[model samples]
Target: MAKSNKPIVWGLFAAGGTVCAFVIPVMILITGVLLPLGLFGPPEASYESMTRIVSNPVVKIVLFGILFLALWHAAHRLRITVHDFGIRNDQLVARAVYGFAGLFSLIALVTLLSF
Candidate 1:
């Protein structure tokens, strides 16, 4: 049997999906609903507060992980979806989607490290 690296990608995809399921809703509630509606106290949603939050090394790493994994997850999902949509070129689609994910992951890493 030929061993493949698909497991690694699948693992990332699963992790990303799990994180997104748990985190995105809370994030939307906080940033999208709570802050804008002024239901929370004193509006700690300012630029400075955001900057401070992202400034912490731990927070930066977590954010980067979430962003990178989410991108990869989306890419893999799109690739599978394309295949399901009757695309016969699996190799080409895989390359394009994973390449896009890698490129964006690099960009996110650079951006996060810059901050």
Candidate 2:
């Protein structure tokens, strides 16, 4: 018997979801580790520490990449989620959801660049 291809779509979705699951927690852990280690400086760290954190070229680039990918991932997943819930009304909803996600992502990128 030949295997069906429909399962492939589900598999891809699962893979993406798994990545998201891991990415979110791992990012959180990094933040926790770095903050306590004073990568952003001590609890008493002043504006200087915050400034230093934002000034690193590598860190800024990585942050921008992560932000863009995360937002795109979120929008794609949310679109599927809304569809799964049987809200088959129009394409507008999906567009709006993805559009808003991208817009916010761009805003974050700009803010990060400035800092």
Candidate 3:
């Protein structure tokens, strides 16, 4: 049997999807709803607290993982959606989508580490 990379791809896809599913909605609720509504105390307090939390190295690594996984998950979905739309040139689509994901993941890593 020919060796295949499907398992590796699928593993990342699954892990990313799981991370996105658990994290994204909570993030949206906090950043989108709670913060603006002042449900998390005052703006200054929230900003200061968030800064403190993100400044920790461990937190930075965790945030980077979440951001990277989320980007990859979205990119994989977009790639599949493009394929479903009958743009059968999968190599191009996969490269474009995954490339964007990789680029954003790198950016996220840098940004997180800057803190």
Candidate 1 lDDT score at position 95: 95
lDDT of 2 by residue, 1-115 (tens): 8889647545544655666676777777767676667676556673677678868888888777666666666766777788788887547776887698779878977888887
- Whole-model lDDT, model 3: 0.89
For model 3, the superposed segments whose C-alpha errors exceed 4 Å read: 40-45
Q: How many clashing residue pairs appear in each of the predictions shown?
A: 0, 1, 0
Query: By TM-score, is 1 or 3 better?
Result: 3
Which segments of candidate 2 are over 4 A away from where they belong? 1-22, 30-47
Say which prediction, candidate 1 or candidate 3, comes out ahead on lDDT: 3
Q: Quick one: RMSD of model 1?
A: 2.9
Candidate 2: 10-residue stretch with minimal lDDT: 6-15
Give each prediction's root-mean-square deviation over alpha carbons: 2.9, 6.2, 1.9
Best by TM-score: 3
Cα miss at 30, model 1 (Å)? Answer: 4.0
Pairs of residues at least 3 apart in sequence or in different chains that clash in candidate 1: none
Clashing pairs in 2: 38-41
